[model samples]
Target: IDPGHGAQDAGAIGNGLLEKNINLEVALKLQSRLHQAGALTVMSRTSDTFDSLQTRVSKGAQASADIFISIHANANDNSGANGTETYYDTTYAAAHSVKLAQQVQPRMVSALGTKDRGVKTAGFYVIKYSRMPSILLETGFVTNPIDASILKSTAAKDRLASGIATGVSNYFDVK
Candidate 1:
């Protein structure tokens, strides 16, 4: 699991919330859930720390991870832009990446009660270079009031984590 940014790189900031922090919290919850589901997981960073995009890709490569999931929150100049979306790159594992996105996207919407921005194709560095089924989840737009409120809730975070974990399990056809 890869939490997008950290430390000096706070990523998107809005409504007094830091994207890095939210990403890490959700990732830690996801790690625990995956562990309970009998899957071994490796995190790019366990605490407030920064890793270059290349470093994150290397971690996934070194671990021989079956799939790479990068967790992040979104932000837009237009605060009205609010929803959950998943992105996949066509550079590698394109089909599997799309399948992974398909599994994950709706689950996030259900968990966060956010609008469905749907899955999309993007050439993000980590997902593009990972060489495995990879996806980047834009959990919600922190800049939007309604979305931010939902994202800031502990119960919602747990549900979002559970949703992501369940999606991953479904992707692998794991019980």
Candidate 2:
């Protein structure tokens, strides 16, 4: 699992919340959930440290992870843009990545009850370069007031983690 941004790179800060922190919080929760579900989970970063995008991909590659999930909160110059979106890169495992996104996207929308921005195609470095089924999730926008409030809640973060872990389990047919 990769939680985008850290340390000096605070990602998107808005409405008194940092995207990196939120991403890490949700990822840590996801790690526990996946571990309980019998998956050997590996994190790109477990603490408030910095890792380059290349390093992030390398970690997953070195581990030979079956799939990659890069978790991130969204931000926009337009604060009105609020919702959850999942992205997959077609340059590599097109069908697999899209399938992963298809499974993950609705779960996130349902979990957060945010706007359904739906799954999209994007060439984000982590997802694109990783040689496994990969997805980058935009889990609501910190720049938006409503999303910021929801992101601030532990319950909301738990819900998001639950949704993602369930999605991964379902995808892998792990019961």
Give the candidate number with the greatest lDDT.
1
Candidate 1, superposed: residue stretches over 4 Å from native: none
Model 2 TM-score is: 0.98
Q: What's model 2's lDDT at 74?
A: 92
Report, for every candidate in turn, its global Cα lDDT versus the true structure.
0.96, 0.93
The sequence of per-residue lDDT tens digits that candidate 1 reaches over residues 1-175 is 9999999999999998999999999999999999999999999999999999999999999999999999999999999999999999999989899999999999999998899999999999999999999999999999999999998999999999999999999999942
RMSD (CA, Å), candidate 1 to true, equals 1.2
Q: Write the per-residue lDDT of candidate 2 for residues 1-77, one digit (tens) a residue.
A: 99999999999999999999999999999999999999999999999999999999999999999999999999999
lDDT score, residue 30, model 1? 98
lDDT accuracy of residue 26 in candidate 2:
94
Candidate 2, residue 117: Cα displacement in angstroms equals: 0.3
